[model samples]
Target: MIEYLIGIAFCLSSALTVLILLLPSQYDPATKDKPSVQILVLGDIGRSPRMQYHALSIAKHGGEVVIIGYKESDPHPDVVSNPKITIIPLRPHPAILQTSNKLLFTIYGPLKVLFQIAYLWKCLAYTAPPSRWLLVQNPPSIPTLAVASISCFLRQTRLVIDWHNFGYSILALKLGQNHPLVKLSIWYEKTFCKSTSAHLCVTDAMGLVLKNDFALQAPILPLHDRPASHFHPITNPQERNEFLNGFPETESVRSSLAAGTLRVLVSSTSWTPDEDFSILIDALVQYSELAAAQPELPEILAVITGKGPQKKMYLEKIAALEVAGQLQKVTVRTAWLTVPDYARLLASASLGVSLHTSSSGVDLPMKVVDMFGAGLPVVGWNRFEAWSELVTEGVNGLGFGSATELTERLIELFGDDKKLETLRVGAQKESTRRWDDEWDPIVGKLLGLT
Candidate 1:
């Protein structure tokens, strides 16, 4: 069945390639004053920050950008208000895909992909302005990579793939690595990815993997994730308090914070399989026990923010732990905050924790970058090789191998104000390095915007 589907996809792609070549050019002579670049994302535009950043950066460098993606949530205000940036929202998948039984996912999944392929092809080839370049996000690489590559080929546009992680590796988390679907996804990614004009990866390790393993011929640049300008420390006590009080969840903890009896710990998650929230839960339980025994240790207000599939499960576990008296000293609160509010929450926090253990060991967590930008020292899962690229052992942040190790690190930092202060200083220094400074030179040159 998989083989049959692959054959059909190949035939359809070949036909589309021929059709696109025969179509009239989309280039408009009137709009030639500035270069046009299309930023393509298969996911929600607002949720996908890196792609939005790309659009913003291109616009900043005198390039007109047409961002094509699902507009599920409101994107950054700057992106919306920018004159050079135009967003073309794709129609969402059928509601039946969401409402259907899990047993029928196999039937629905391919149908959805087919819909996406047709819609995406129309947007890229016909709907959006003719572009000099098309920058696309990976991990929804299935049809996007193939479709974008072919469209770029036919239109003579440079196809630049921004690799976050291997789509196959992520699929393997659900279906084991040896599964037929996973194998097919691997083949699809490798086959289409090689056709891209250039590559921009999140980590150096990822670049190495692409070069050594995938044997990609294109020039691969490791464009590490950096925090945007909005993510900065709120140094003023009054400003921090005002922002904290604005949120109903943080309002209850204000008295404790004012009394100097509580320490705020922030964690951002997508509640995905790659991030093991169990480790955090267990660590919090241990910390609760330690705080109970050691009176000097401050109570913890753990603010975990983000929307995801596993959120309800984790929330239930936290509630159960609290009821069973396993989390007396730790208060685990989950929230879904706007981007600006999230940054402020991180800045106001005493420390940040990251549960992301990368699906592809080469990819780095953007959450850590955001935390560093907000001047909060992070305690991250250090099992992956790419963790070292973003986190230094004792410099800006700490890395933990297990729940016990995370618990120890948490206690050590909260117990000693001097140690935490030193790390915070390092984190603050990291915040000075913004995204535009790095992006403009390398990416600008790649897109010919410079």
Candidate 2:
């Protein structure tokens, strides 16, 4: 009995040892024979759509991309299906690292060695094994960048920065153009850009900002998300019903519109102080006469999508305006929509709305691309510095100046069915020719699958 027990113990111990050896390791895999490039993607991997897309892009590029992301955002369903993608969660709270950021902010402000300290704290917590190569996807959080920089130094790895959002621009917007923090962020951007192997950006606008604003010579890789393609328009009742759930009272509106009520659909981030949704809302109020006179006149419904930090404030404003009856008139889709679903939803609508005030002129939202893909006519409020050039008035879409002009333009378009059809066709052509055309190549090149 004693001999048998000893034999079993030995077998169990060997099995346990093998299991330990087979566990996942952070060490760079053996790449002596293969062309191995390890990329360490960091920063807002949870929030930034571009970063989310970057995972797919890197995997498609055929590189060994290891993503270090925040644990708060939960699993990205689309990314989970890709086998080549490896996600490492950096847990965010109840830990010294998270608290360390507060300390750094207090000591040095946003740009002080504070980010570096927080990053170091993250490094200590995430210590597992090191890789031979690393790439950072525009480390926005100073601490995260510090951690990434530290990892590269320790591992003797290459650091690649993808600047999707210009940090200085954001700081300038938040703290004023001449704010000290803005200047510091600008300095950091200049310092980092000169050293990185490649600086990836999404638009020529950003490239100009880097070259002119910062004087950097890094190669700019203009990355665009996959554009809308092959979306069948909403024609069936069941399809319309699905869209109605998102649009609120779509069925009644659809019936009324078919009988000659001009139906205009609008969607935006929210009725934020900056968005100028009030401009559109006020326009509708001014055009109440038009709605009444042409009982068959166009009924305008603005669909508000996305929840923000100021959602409650906006909701309160909506209620205070007594536009709750207009709730059916202007629906708010509070839940997040996947990129493809968002595209389809936009396609079902007649128009998409985008407006920016002086404070947010530089924001070229992802929705603009979706609107183009869906071939929906866009009514953009030009506040200067906007990509409003994309919407040429009376060509593919219309550009409005104020609420009064916007209301007049909508009424004009509502009466002209032939013009609407012409614009719709032009919008579709422009969208497919320009925006959606780059998808296969962009995705292909990024994945190295091309």
| Model 2, span 3-58: residue lDDT tens | 99999999999999996664434444464322233444444354555555555555
Candidate 1 weakest ten by summed lDDT: 97-106
Best by lDDT: 1
Per-residue C-alpha lDDT of model 1 across residues 213-256, encoded as one tens digit per residue: 89999999999999999999877878876776776786767787
Tell me how many clashing residue pairs each candidate has: 0, 10
**Global fold similarity of model 1 (TM-score):** 0.92
Candidate 1 lDDT score relative to the true structure: 0.88
Cα TM-score per model: 0.92, 0.73
Error of 1 at 214 (Å): 1.4
